[model samples]
Target: MTSYYDQRGVGLIEVMVAILLLSIAVLGFSALQMRAINATDESLVRTKSLTLVRNLSEIMRAYPNAYVTGSATSFTTASPTATGAVSTVQAVMSSSATSTVTVDAKTIDITTSANGCLSTGTKQETVDSIVKTVPAQHCNMSQLAARDTLMAKKIAKDEDISMTVVTCPGTTTQAIQTQMCVIAAWNDTKAILSDSDANACATSNGVYKTDSHCLISEAY
Candidate 1:
């Protein structure tokens, strides 16, 4: 009888060990599945961010003058009065030496007065035709750029995305050229695993806060 009881106790110990091992395997699989889900979510967010950046780049290319020469303006779609739904589109036009002016229907010649002062002399000729002032087409490039930027944000369906257009000076062999840059930034839904991961996803500002992604593109 004593030998039989000892054998029964040994059998119970073996069964307990098997159950422990099985529990460990189940837990390992659950952890792996959670990681896979997180990875998929991160990938989707990255795709959306890239698409937003590319769309804004195309807008800048469409209206080069407004993006490069107009005053810097910022528009936000969150505002009640906002016409577009972009999170924010900031653009500025650069200054240039060109001007549009209107003159009478007369021929003017550049002449110097007695005191060497520059003066305009109108030539007295036969008047045959009446000159009508043609209004210049106000290049509302700034407005258009802002509108398109907002439209892109709306299309992406992400309100956290923001775009900025700025003129950056570039040096050439002949003269300085103005370059436009379209920068887009958005908050990433993925959680950062480590300091290295955050660094790898840093933006142009060198900020690795583990919360956002950024992209930039330039055009002449």
Candidate 2:
């Protein structure tokens, strides 16, 4: 017959081996959980960025006239600084996003001022300009340069994204203008490809590049 003490000691080495294997398994599972958490965080950031972009588009639509005529004024300033233009608003919108995610129409210079109206009539030499006096833009001009800046912040330090304002292929003056698309993507990092680039055509890393990946169209 085997002694109880002898059997107990014999199982000790096996128990030690089992404990070591369990520890290793737990460590491996923890690593995978960390990776999953990181991925979820990244997804949340991207979603927030896209939602911000959409909010901007809605704001632009609210002021259709100012955007089209290039008569938009700076957001904070009361006076109209320049002839109605897209470049002015675009620059401000992009720069502002780095600091504040939510931007009002005034921030982009989309607001109009009384000074923009013309002075008429020799007797009084002044006229209260009608709301219709200054023709507004036909279609609202939505700016998305801010998206590129936000994208850069999420990616690698060396990575930079490009934002190209692509106008619909036609005269923008029409009542129902074709939806203009805003193309933004990481230019330096192959991890993210531009919409038109051939690299976007490939399926890799179990993630395929769709319209939501690179290009953001402002058209509703």
Candidate 3:
């Protein structure tokens, strides 16, 4: 004869097994949710990086001379002493030359023949003198491309981003037709995304990288 106590004992064992299975299912669902959140964060970062790279490209287009004329030079100040005076300084700097001057407690990098002024330590208002009154008849596209590449690196540095600009054929020879590739890379520890091209940017431990290419024609 089946005893009532035996029946109750069997029921308890079945309930325990069901509860254990539910716990495992809940843990799996939680892990999946966490992964989704990580993926979303990675996507946002990648989108921002792409926007920055594109912004740089547009800036290059606007200041073709600054990028194309390898003639631009830069210099650092000998010693910058802070002055209580607060005023804007304007100077005409020549291309391929660098001048460092102290202005209003800030050290300013004045690049002659280029657009804009860079300040170190503290921000200062500066008005740059336009060096070129007339445009050049011919520009060395290769040199300009190289200059643009350097500018991209500087702009992306604040975000811990890495950038590379490469002209096709990898030569300094001036050409009327060439393609320029801009690559941006950043560390993505989660390894949620893949790079656009294996050689476009360096990758380690789940780094995400992308590249943008544009064709330039310098017709005489």
Candidate 4:
């Protein structure tokens, strides 16, 4: 048997060990919480981007014959050159000149008054489809397309998301058809299939890039 006096420091040692373990647990929890928050943020952005891309597809479909099937329009990441950087790009079409928007000395792609895309405003996406003419006159295809572009752009800007709208090489096995692609880009540095490269968005031909941080939707 040992006296309490002889064991005086034993309790202190145990207490210190407990404290060390507790501190480690706290640090781990903190890290996990931060990771969860980041994941949530990434998910939110991606969802919004997908919605916007779909919206664009519907807009194009609504205005039949407005879009020239051969041409392409991209409202893509602000920094297409930088891989995995958190930025938006909006590629405008000209069919002749490239229209771009610059900020902080960085250039982003935006669509111009191209044959397929009408450059204009955001959201109010459904407004154009309302046929708000006073006498219900025939709607101009070009006007509708332009309004659709603007509405899409505004919505994208509001969500802080990037966009890319392009015409893809549709399959022609049976009959001639056209395919339109809409891409929503976001920061997806830490994700699956991303282990390969950071160019998973749309290419010039509207094909998906492997491991890139973007989503694509199609219209025909």
Q: Which candidate wins on lDDT?
A: 4
Compose the digit string of candidate 2's lDDT tens values, residues 1-220: 4676567766789999999999999999999999999778656655654554454455345433333222322232112233433432343333434432222342321122222122232222223653333233111223233223233333322234334333333425333223544434443223232355555521332234653344344442
Give the TM-scores of the predictions, in the order they appear.
Answer: 0.51, 0.43, 0.47, 0.57
For model 1, residues 132-197, the per-residue Cα lDDT tens digits are 432222113344444455456455544555445443324232112235455455564221212455
lDDT of 3 by residue, 119-147 (tens): 12332333375443333312233233333
Sliding window of 10 residues with minimal summed lDDT for model 2: 109-118
Total backbone collisions for each predicted model: 4, 11, 8, 30
- The C-alpha local distance difference test score for the whole of candidate 2 amounts to 0.39
Candidate 2: residue 129 lDDT (0-100) = 55
Question: Model 1: clashing residue pairs?
Answer: 68-94, 69-93, 69-94, 70-93
Q: What 10-residue stretch in candidate 3 is worst by lDDT?
A: 85-94
After superposition, the stretches of candidate 4 with alpha carbons farther than 4 Å from their true spots are 1-5, 68-139, 169-177, 188-211
Candidate 3: the clashing residue pairs are: 67-144, 68-144, 71-96, 72-96, 73-96, 75-98, 93-112, 94-112
Instruction: Give me the displacement of residue 139 in model 3, in angstroms.
Output: 18
